[model samples]
Target: MSNTASLKKEYAERIVPALKSQFHYSSSMQVPVLKKIVINQGMGIAVADKKLIEIAINEITAITGQKAVATISRKDISNFKLRKKMPIGVMVTLRHEKMYEFLERLVRVALPRIRDFKGIESRFDGRGSYTLGIQEQIIFPEINIDSIT
Candidate 1:
């Protein structure tokens, strides 16, 4: 894919050199690169209908092209009717090629489709990692609108 090829070229020709110059690093390996893309969805309704977790898992899989694993509660909360080991969310971690592909789709396709869209915030964590939250999965072209419920 052109996106994949261009991203690779950008990293090699642009990013690696920029990092090396900025950080005064001697080896190309010292430059940081995107390691993974994590897609997560919290299934609060799973407490009422366990099947909801499966739907979230399927949605995440469609968006990321990877199967999602359930995230269980780490502790019990009596008032909230939560228990340890209860599946409360689904997450997929995309590495290597999949991570780059998903990013290309997100930046080139999905983000532009939103109404009244401004550019994304340029905020990052101290560690240089960024997180983006999408309001709906239908914004992704891979998902068929008619199939959404």
Candidate 2:
């Protein structure tokens, strides 16, 4: 979409220069750049109902504009009655153009619609990446309210 194009252009035209001046970066690579955006939805109930996992995958695919991959357990935990290779959640990794498009939609359209919005809690990771959790996927326009299962 055009949003992705403008985002990339803005980075090159505006953001890069600002970073170069502020940090006095000798090289463009050190200024840092966004690599990917990962959208995840965890469905613990899927352990009880396999149908729920399929439904989750469909919903995540609709939200991210990409096929969703089911996240399986790495090892069995007897306390939780969880087993290895059992579908527990669904997720999609958006990269390049898709990442920009999703981010633009999230900031511009979806987030504001959340009822009683009180800003977000963001935590940065080891590198420059950060993780943000959205409790409701219904905030995005892509998901149909009636179609929710």
Candidate 3:
């Protein structure tokens, strides 16, 4: 099957239902197919907690089970004032059909499980791009203090 068709099928048959069932939200959750995922390690985080950047990378890698590299988007970085900490953002491209499947699982199972969770707030960049803030990262099934080395 063509990638596009597979993506459509995946979205329609799998992702849509999962979102509704798991998140209590519709399949039309409205995530655009990402061309790339960028992890904007903002200066705020860079200065406040240098290790946090790595922590985000490690956590994303573990949760997504994908090799996600951390990079600085200068545009994202420049938006911040140097004196204050910047919020670090992770961007992942979802153009591949497989990404839809991963996104489905992540949104449905992994994300909502976070403790003290609230709905995700998204801002569409209007260039087929959106930015979302995940208030905190807790309740991930893989996390266990005892399990950590």
Candidate 4:
């Protein structure tokens, strides 16, 4: 089995029981689990150059191993010169195996490469969700540096 599958199995067998015992939970379903990972990038400058959106799409695809879908503006804004249905951003939603694999790489590899890194903050909303923001896409080892623009 792949590393991610085995890691998931280990979590189910070891972590789940510990969590249940610690939290006084009755069912295993009460344990928190990673649901999905969403990567998003706004293409505001794409308004000036349409090719920027395509480049953003390619970069997102290379990072996530999935095609990104364009996000459209819902309302027209005269001040920003925005129109309805304009391609404003790109995003990829990763779930299941892909999500786990990405999480594994993010935790084990990419995060450590950040200069002067201490540790991730242990903050979360009331809901069982966490969000992390990355400043540069180059941190991930998967992307070929020569190809990036």
TM-score, each model? 0.87, 0.91, 0.49, 0.90
* Residue-wise C-alpha lDDT for candidate 4, range 8-85, written one tens digit per residue: 998899999999999999999988888899999987877777787888888888877888988989999888889999
The TM-score, computed over Cα atoms with residue i paired to residue i, of candidate 3 is 0.49
List RMSD in Å for every model shown.
2.0, 1.6, 8.2, 1.5
Which whole-number lDDT from 0 to 100 does residue 72 have in model 1?
Answer: 96
Q: Hey, what RMSD does candidate 4 come out at? A: 1.5
TM-score ranking, high to low: 2, 4, 1, 3
**lDDT agreement of model 4 with the native:** 0.86
List of clashing residue pairs for candidate 1: none
lDDT of 3 at 39: 31
Candidate 2: residue 3 lDDT (0-100): 81
Model 2 root-mean-square deviation: 1.6
lDDT of 1 at 53: 88
Cand. 1 TM to true fold: 0.87
Better of 1 and 2 by TM-score: 2
lDDT tens string, model 2, 29-140? Answer: 8888888888888888888999998988888888788999999999999888899999999989999988998988988899999999887777677877787878888999
Which should have the higher TM-score, number 1 or number 3? 1
Question: For residues 31-138, what per-residue lDDT tens digits would candidate 1 score against the true structure?
Answer: 878888888898877988898888888888888988899999999998779999999999989998888889989988999998889989989999988988888888
How many backbone clashes does every candidate have?
0, 0, 7, 0
State the lDDT of candidate 3 residue by residue for 1-149, as single tens digits: 65446666876788777767776654465433355443332324554565766766676666555665655544434445333223344434444554655555657676778776677766666676666555434445555545443
- lDDT of model 2 at position 147: 81
